[model samples]
Target: MVKWIVKFRNERSHLWAKVVMAIHSGGRSFTTIPIKNSISGVWKNIVQLGKGSSLKLSDVQNRLEVKMGCGDKIFFWLDKWVGDYSLKDRFPDLFAVQTDKFCLVQQRYSLTNGEIVWSWGGESPATHTDMAETWAECVKLLEGVKIEKKSDMWLWKQEDKQEVFKVSDLRSELDGMDLIPET
Candidate 1:
């Protein structure tokens, strides 16, 4: 239900966007982007359920895989667009010296008439000692990727590539994970 609501948060109705902002923001608006502990009446119960439940919101987010088309919607460093990790998470040393961490995949990469070009924010991380090695691997990893003109989507990684997200599938996947510590 939360993912369904969030999927329509930006593209659908104005009221839905407002509600999403309220709920996802934890009642706090633009002022506090990361802080929790403050939730409005509408989402207080949901937040509480998340806290008491075995599956966490962060866990679900970590398992999400993005199908990039234009790449405008997905964050470059923050979102998990690659196989299993975000670029920042996959390459922390290189990310530390990055010129523009916020640059989206669309901005950093482009396809011109069948040719794929990666701009990489036009900066080379010369300061890092492992820059040469990491950059080469990063380049090779990005070489196969291309940006097509289509809508992006957040796919549940537990399902097949063509499969649509089902709450049952997500629940089962989450249930399979070890939520309790064994002594």
Candidate 2:
């Protein structure tokens, strides 16, 4: 189930991925969409697996890492495109004050007169020292990350050399796991 979702994320241009996105997520990001009760078959099963009491959505997300390029597809705060974790997780205080939580990385910054101009979504009040410090740290991290013309890539965190997705590996992993807990 995690493998399917991971494959969908990594191969957004693939026909199967496109069909799943259109039918399951309604052309929206798979991460943001809610799984409906009416949903059936593979999509429903995958969604249910991710939403299981024991298997969290973060558990699946944590398996993939993003390398931001054009930054259009990568969620600015939600995606683990920069650093070890998402900015929302790393800077909780700033995330709480963020106006647009779903804003893309490209939306946060612009190229103007050959310089990168950052336009933050919300104002961080000066009185909150924690938020202010967090905001500065987040900005400092962003400064070093240059948005380029290349397409963004999502690599499997478990893979050492390539961004390849193998169903056999996932099958072996599942075969070793105890899916049901003895209550």
Give per-residue CA lDDT, model 1, range 1-183, as digits (tens).
345423542242357544554455432122111224554554455545555667665655655566777776566765667767778778887776666665557777667688887654536645455677777788788877767688676666554453446678767766787878799
TM-score of each: 0.60, 0.66
lDDT of 2 by residue, 1-183 (tens): 767776666566689766765676532232533244565877778867767645477666776667778886677877777777778888877776776776778788889898887676776553467666667778888888878888777665554654555777666766877978779
Model 2: residue 7 alpha-carbon error in angstroms: 4.6
For model 1, the local distance difference test gives: 0.59
Count of steric clashes across candidates, in order: 0, 0
RMSD of 2: 5.2
Local distance difference test values of all predictions, in order? 0.59, 0.69
Angstrom error of the Cα, residue 28, model 1: value is: 18
Candidate 2 lDDT at 100 equals 73
In candidate 2, where is summed lDDT lowest over 10 consecutive residues? 26-35
Candidate 1 — worst ten consecutive residues by lDDT sum? Answer: 26-35
Model 1 bad stretches (over 4 Å): 4-49, 122-133, 157-162, 166-183
